[model samples]
Target: MSRHHDVVVIGGGQAGLAAGYHLRRLGLDFVILDARTTPGGAWQHTWGSLRLFSPAAYSSLPGRLMPPQEGQTYPDGAHVIEYLTEYEQRYGLPIVRPVAVDAVRRDGDRLRVESGSGEWRARAVISATGTWWRPFMPAVPGRAEFEGTQLHTVEYRRPADLAGQRVIVVGGGNSGAQIAADLAHETDLTWVTQRPPRFLADDIDGRALFDHATARRRALDEGRTDTGGVASLGDIVAVPPVREARDAGLLKAQPMFARMTATGVEWADGTTAEADTIVWCTGFRPALSHLAPLGLRGPRGHIPTAGTRALGEPRLHLLGYGDWTGPASATLIGVGRPARDAARAIAELLAEA
Candidate 1:
């Protein structure tokens, strides 16, 4: 059905849900368009062994805190999925499932969102489609010649898939480190990074990162500067398995190789390492293809925004894109402020018109 809404929140993940909460508070007529048949956003696609670096207390959305499971200090993907599903249901948020948005264009003063089923017109569109779909792979020479299995972090499901195989895990982020640790048990594994990864002290975790993020944002909002030495979540937190792997020396990663060889990869030092599989844990780009028809995006497919409100395109707002959209915006805890402020701004703008 082609219809109109006061606001349309896209993606229905943590960011979208947070926006929906604020929209509900303001009594706005909004619909959340989600691509997934189930809840949990990209968490469903992560490796089975993945765990949140933070405890449940530090990993919640806007309205509800994720209740820690009995005796479960850190929640797994399944637990997060369960909480997201419950959050959607608990708020009675209106979500259209599996309706992939193809394009967003302007019609008069409103924006039309085209999807497989139909189209939706909204006065304000909040693009919460995070950076999980567009996996990035660096251009390495001879990648095509490598006669081995290669998969991005998005396609990885579990460790058993590469059992007994020689696997090279690429990227130094949390995902790469965790996946490398898991695969080390099931295969002959090596880790590769562009530069050495920074790990926080063993006593720190997601809580400290969240606090640092808040402090930095507060400093910026007050027109001051946050000095360095604040720990970013980019630094690896010593999770249990990662700690074990570090102790076992499996967490060490060599510098990025120069090129891919016929069987595997070759380092700059002229040493060659052969592997049956290569898992690229490289990160993703923002999933903003649906807005291509609007022709408003600039660098890296993101539009300029003032506190989540799209600057040039006044009717649009983008949220939960790593630091650009909002401070630490990609995380579960960081999305709330932007979502709430965006929703309020949309309400005020719509009320004026």
Candidate 2:
């Protein structure tokens, strides 16, 4: 027998929690399904020293503001986890853990969510499963033949793990920059990017990036030309550690190598450099494999969304993947708006039904 709910949230991360908060307030019969054994979502898996781009004041979900961390302007991963654990408790959101959802497919006027624990039928399904599980690693030629260790951002934990090794951090995103900086003093580190790294001004932080997203959203809603949002700002934010590393000449990047060698990498010009490990900070794609059965994905593997609702299948809503679902929706502070919108839309959707 499948449990039934008015709505089902497919993640327990910041995005799922945000959706649950609104759904509870609206008095909806909903449940949040999380795969982890405990709370904290993806934060529990991040590196020990990973810091937020904004202060706790600026990084919060709806209803509860993340309390300021003592002696820390930008909170670390542990702090965020603490806040998330508390946030779920504070709201008493209904969530089931250790339930890995295998697939979501269409049913008779509802959606069937198949999971390890059991199954669920819901009038609406909100997939807030973010990109953490789907780490993207570019297939540099000869990568399989390389003898050195290679790990993506998801597998990284701390600098001490790679201490004393000759490490090359690949990709130019925030993760690449932050990880490279974190490893610089501890190892012989080289940073490589397909193009040169673009760092945001020292003064700019997540708050500024959110504001940019807001403006771009407003412009698009008004049918005006879109202002490229955070991309217009730069690729990487110069948070305290990264900025300090750049100032100290420890954070310089080289162009991406043409291919990997048996022991290292070679540039297009045939220059070769050796390394003990290659850390791929190459980012992630949406963890939507569970939704593949729905067959709503486009050529890019993204579900076409109108606001947060899937265009092809209105019963499905996607949250927290990125700006495509909602502007800044991937960030802690930015996810609230979309979560609220999705819940309200579901309410209206159910009402009409």
TM-score, cand. 1 vs. native: 0.97
| Per-residue lDDT of model 1, residues 113-138, tens digit only | 99997899999999999988899988
Clashes of each: 0, 0
Q: In candidate 2, residue 262 scores what lDDT?
A: 84
Question: Which regions of candidate 1 fall more than 4 Å away from where they truly are?
Answer: 229-234
91-189: candidate 2 lDDT, tens digit per residue? 999999989999999999999999879999999999999999899998889999899899999899899999999999998989999999999999999
Query: Which runs in model 2 stand beyond 4 Å of their true positions?
Result: none
